[model samples]
Target: MFSEPEEPTATRMRRARATACAALKVEDAAQNPIWGYAGRTLSGLVHGSEEDGWLRVVSETAARAGGRLWEGPRTASFALPASVPRPALHRIHDWTEEGWSYRAELYAYAPASVVSPGPVLDTDLDLSEAWWAGLGTALDALAAVPTDRVSMREEYIRRAVAEFTGHAVGGIPWSTAHGDLHWANLTGPELLILDWEGWGRAPYGFDAALLHIYALRAPETANHVRKTLAHFLDDPAVRVAELTVCAQVLQAADRTPFYAALADPVRRYLKRMGRGAV
Candidate 1:
């Protein structure tokens, strides 16, 4: 269908990206291609004579890997409300070459710059008052937009909450969420949430909760996020969102050294909440 040669993975990813750009008829403007977890996706910038956009390429070794879900972000621009602060999708190219499937999306340029391109935020961000206000507005507007897309399965949420929070949950207050609200997916000075592959309905306050969890290592900033999104704090749904995010991070910890720091903070958080995860 499309590309990994490592086992040739990195090389295959790059070649796949180049071929995608050529097929899409865009010029590569980035010095380097940004890679996703384990190099499953590769992304860079592309430009024509007068226009520029971010070009992202994704590969799957199997026909059913992520299936239809991976197309959410690629098509999100056409459906999400204008109030949502995100780039507009310009074009998409999908094809099968050499037994691999590749899908490339070119989106209107993202302005300002990314806050952090990693899952964890170690530095304290001195975000502006306007930026904080904008984040709140964006989250609120996003929540109001209705969608049938499922970010996390109902059964998965029940099981994860029970496993991590040590309690059974019912009647979750659902709202649209970016699903992945880590520092890596956010931009600042101005607020622009990126990478919306999993945007869909989730428990209330999910975005705020996930954002807080990622900032836990930077205590001051984490506190700032909670304070900024205070309306979302103290809700039962938010608490569930928090612990569930903790479970996700803990799972990531075992695989990547960078995420290992998040596990202790999660345990401390659980203890504070009077719950213990076995």
Candidate 2:
């Protein structure tokens, strides 16, 4: 029995990318790019003019939520300095000039994220102990950026509490957080945090709590995160943050397979901590 020849993966990717680009109406979009795709939209990271900076084409809804999404698929650029370790929204472009209605927005790209060794849930990252110190420094730097982005609010916490634990959430210490601090959003080797759209004030330990929960599949890594960021996780407000993130994870398990392994442990954690036992 003879088998049909297979299409080269590169060729397949190129074809798919071409289709996506054509759909987005970005004729200038790079062929091979780092894609942040969700549902029907595509956020492709591509190079830009040295003076203008990089470009990122994202879904219209997502772009509107962060930048100027209501401005009719327009482009908005940030004046952020290059020294910052964030891919802050630089500029956004609407497809209206091209008379296209694909419901996508283009953005000026930020500094590329570091090449990760592996997924955060795969295993303990082989980072140096000194790198942990640097991680603290980087987090501190991120915290210093004054932003109004509110990743989680009291109502969100209350809903999660009522739906999952049925316990009232207490006072939470608020601080600037990188709302989505997962392995995929984080870049390593050089330790750069990606995706700043979620940067904003949140419960004190919210970021660390989320990170620890994601690391649960690998207990050793989870333990390491707890130990390293103990100052944040050890706070009294951590109870609220932990429940909040766990509830959020449980909710997410229904939608994405990424949080499948986390669903059970998160429930157990909520039961333990939700009763104010922790």
Error of 2 at 91 (Å): 4.7
Question: lDDT by residue for model 2 over 8-69, one digit each (tens)?
Answer: 43343344445444554445444445544332233455433443333443333322334422
Off by over 4 Å in 1: 1-7, 65-68, 276-278
lDDT tens digits, residue span 1-278, model 1: 01223457898888888898898888888786677766788887888667888899888865665543677886578768877888778888888878888888888887677888586887788889888888888888888888888887778878877865575676777888888877877788778888888889888888999888888889888988888899887665576677677767776778766569778887788778775432
Whole-model lDDT per candidate: 0.79, 0.57
- lDDT (0-100) at residue 36 of candidate 1? 79
Tell me how far the alpha carbon of residue 211 in candidate 1 is from the true structure, in angstroms, after superposition. 0.6
Clashes of each: 9, 12
In terms of TM-score, the best-performing candidate is 1
Off by over 4 Å in 2: 1-34, 40-54, 61-84, 87-91, 97-120, 271-274
Name the candidate that leads on lDDT: 1
